[model samples]
Target: MSNYPINPSTIAAPHSQSPLGANISSASLTTEQEFETGIRIIRDAYRKKIATKDAEIDALYKDLRRRDAEIQ
Candidate 1:
């Protein structure tokens, strides 16, 4: 057989490490601190929404009062 160069592709190397959170670790990632942080985030969102809605409701109420006064 004529001298044929060995293919480098045929050589095997150590298995490459997999990306993180490819399995059960992802589910276990949450801990007590994370839970608290998530709760805080959600509460802040709701509080902001409530504050905005309160302002909108107050504006609507004032508009309604003005309409009533106009009618009178």
Candidate 2:
């Protein structure tokens, strides 16, 4: 054969589809808007979740102190 390399066809599958891929149509404006909105919503949710968790931890600490006083 000429000065060329032979690669297996099965080994050359595509790594990834184009940036947006077939899942998102190029003309879908609502998808883009929702994506941005989703990012903001998730961020807000995370903040609220953290605040709730902190409140629970504080309550647990108070309960522990009350129980410790009973043990003394």
Candidate 3:
């Protein structure tokens, strides 16, 4: 419910755990457009990696099938 934005600067340095015993420096803020574009790029890269893995799995299955047919 708090309207305040959260970042390193806004966060309270935990009194008991902080080595510096102080809050961290301000974090770099990202614009909405920049954030969305970054997210999209990351998603595309992840999807591509998954697709490549799927293709490799399919190739392994095909090789197994071929070997089984040869044995039979």
- Largest TM-score belongs to which candidate? 3
TM-score for each prediction? 0.57, 0.49, 0.57
The runs of at least 3 residues in candidate 1 whose Cα sits more than 4 Å from the true structure, single-residue gaps closed, are 1-30
lDDT of 1: 0.69
Error of 3 at 54 (Å): 0.6
Candidate 1 per-residue lDDT, tens place, 1-72, comes to 769998989976544323332333444444454566567778999999999999999999999999999999
Compared with the true structure, the alpha-carbon lDDT of candidate 3 equals 0.67
Q: In model 2, how large is the Cα lDDT of residue 2?
A: 75
Candidate models: Cα lDDT each: 0.69, 0.70, 0.67
Provide the lDDT at 42 for model 3: 82
Return the lDDT, model 3, position 45: 95
- How does candidate 1 fare on TM-score? 0.57
lDDT of 3 by residue, 3-49 (tens): 97778876775443332212224233334544665677789999999
Residue pairs whose backbone atoms clash in candidate 1:
none
TM-score of model 2 relative to the true fold? 0.49
